[model samples]
Target: MDGADYLHPGSEWAKEPDDIDSIDFSPTVTIMYFADDDTWQAVWGGREQLGEFEGTREEAIAWARERCNTIRIYSPSEGDIVDLVPDE
Candidate 1:
């Protein structure tokens, strides 16, 4: 896929109260995508973990665009790293 095909949406992820407790915030959105060779993966997550996805790079990008403020594209070899931190 062409790099230009990648699209990112703003404010796709937001800090919201949990369903169990409206006063508590524990929700987030995460999206993961794999490279063309399947050897690499890109994962994107929100402040919590409300939404999550794991698949090809295309799928991850699509998922993030649909449910994340920013899509972090990286290789699976990078390990599980925190791309962003929540603000208090």
Candidate 2:
């Protein structure tokens, strides 16, 4: 299946299983900030937290489109949707 196949209804986007598996489990939305510098902050979610990840922004958008939903990427200016990645 493609990235679109994994999107959940009403959600902004979904990631392929490969990508989702890479993200560190968190209780909340992972937050990343960009200013003079870039910083990333992760929020852990409860066991009930449900979501997925994409390998790229385009994939994420496609997932969103498949679900008829819109995603807002977290940014300092207006926020931007981005594919979640695992921390090194």
Candidate 3:
């Protein structure tokens, strides 16, 4: 498989990569929208608490996307979405 295969949705690498067994994909930032506070907070890895933003969900995702490859965005009423933003 090619390098791009690693990023493909149904590619072998994306499925179950066997090449780098020791690699670790961790510390993915998570963005959550709080309706009470009317703010979007970017939490790092666990609950380290990165920063709060006064913008839309897309902006929060873009912010988290800039810091890490994987992101978990949560919405108050719409549930949550996990995204694996590929590195360019």
Candidate 4:
């Protein structure tokens, strides 16, 4: 396999695949608030338990940035989700 294969599976022999960044999927990081626990949960890879945090969203973002490329904060009260990763 060629070096390009690592980036796009089989681009060396087959058609080059679409960019992974353009693919629409679930977020890599999520900051969720629990009313019962009154704590913020930093979820990684949609399922992996990264651990929990306390205080403002800024703190959570800082914590998540160290581990993930894209981060999302979900507000249960507002019932909305915010994406922290900027557009490329």
Best by TM-score: 4
Q: Give per-residue lDDT, candidate 4, residue 31.
A: 73
1 or 2, greater by lDDT: 1
Per-candidate local distance difference test: 0.42, 0.39, 0.55, 0.58
Ranking by TM-score: 4, 3, 1, 2
Candidates 2 and 4: which is better by lDDT?
A: 4
Candidate RMSDs in order = 12.3, 14.8, 10.8, 13.4
Q: Which lDDT value does model 2 have at 43?
A: 29
By the TM-score metric, which is better: model 2 or model 3?
3
lDDT of 1: 0.42
Question: What TM-score does model 1 achieve against the real structure?
Answer: 0.36
Greater TM-score among 3 and 4 belongs to 4
- lDDT score, candidate 1, position 17: 35
Model 3 lDDT tens row, 1-88: 2323213354333355555556554667756555655666666663345554546666776777777667755533333334534541
Score candidate 2 by lDDT. 0.39
Best by lDDT: 4
User: Candidate 2: deviation at residue 41, Å?
Assistant: 13
lDDT of 4 by residue, 1-88 (tens): 2212223332222354477565555547767665555666676764345455666667777888877787866644435455665541
